[model samples]
Target: MTTALLPPATDADLAVLREQLGRPARGVVGIAARCVCGNPTVVATSPRLPDGTPFPTFYYLTHPAATAAMSVLEADHVMRELADALAEDEDLQAAYLRAHESYLADRAAYGEVPEIEGISAGGMPTRVKCLHALAGHALAAGPGVNPIGDLALARSSWSPRRCVCAQPGAAG
Candidate 1:
């Protein structure tokens, strides 16, 4: 199922996001995905920031546990493995290109930014640069859209199905 954008962020939601990110979330359009405990997970950011900066990453992952999981995978050099798999699989390459197109379309819905035109985050349509960005897109867009993101999620120790937001020292 596609994860619809939540209603406009409330003051409380903003506060949680601040804590989750350890800073103010700039140009957040809405909460794209939420934790089971109702905390913001994936945030939909504007194509451009409030300060005239072209921000290409529309689906920003904010969940601390999820972010950490992606980081761990990166540290383990899983991106190299994924990249190799992509090179060997024609269907996967096609799906990844589709994912790149979908990402561009989703960002375009917010606004157009010339500086970031045709650029989707995570080195999409070509390379696996950032698993966090890919996973963010996966969580926001739902399964079957981004196969690489889904694969990373499958390999990660964290699961969005469970709520870790309330756990002590979770912080995000």
Candidate 2:
């Protein structure tokens, strides 16, 4: 959350994550990105979960407002429109391919999970499946890294510049 890179997860962070998820946060490695108010926007998760499942989603969006906004976009069929754009725009397709590579590299930094190799969240590099995952990737990697993610976040009701955390201590 601070400019110092991701800090290790602590008890308080876990507690807040549990509250945010309505279940315990599993295999969280660090806070990948934070909201403007310092609440966690994306938490970097382990490639392999505690239950021995190979989890592919390394950057998990935990902020309630951000998730909700992405949900709204999904509800409005924004992914279909984005997929159409990906089909029509070669530049966007190229950028999204790069983003896919970046996501694989980032996840590999944690550990390897062969089951999920070459796979990134939100159906990246091909189609727009989930804006929440793309937005999480965007927030974690910063702008211009994930083009569709940036577009989704820009078009969404949520803003990284805003703090919509339900409570002061609530973060993932």
- Kindly provide the TM-score of model 1 when superposed on the true structure, using C-alpha atoms: 0.95
TM-score, predicted candidate 2 vs. hidden true structure: 0.92
The 10-residue segment with the lowest total lDDT in model 2: 1-10
TM-score of each: 0.95, 0.92
The lDDT for every candidate, in the order shown, is 0.90, 0.87
lDDT of 1: 0.90
Clashing residue pairs for model 2? none
List, residue by residue over 68-169, the lDDT tens digit for candidate 2.
889999999999999999999999999999999899888888888989988989998898998989999999999999999999999998898977775554
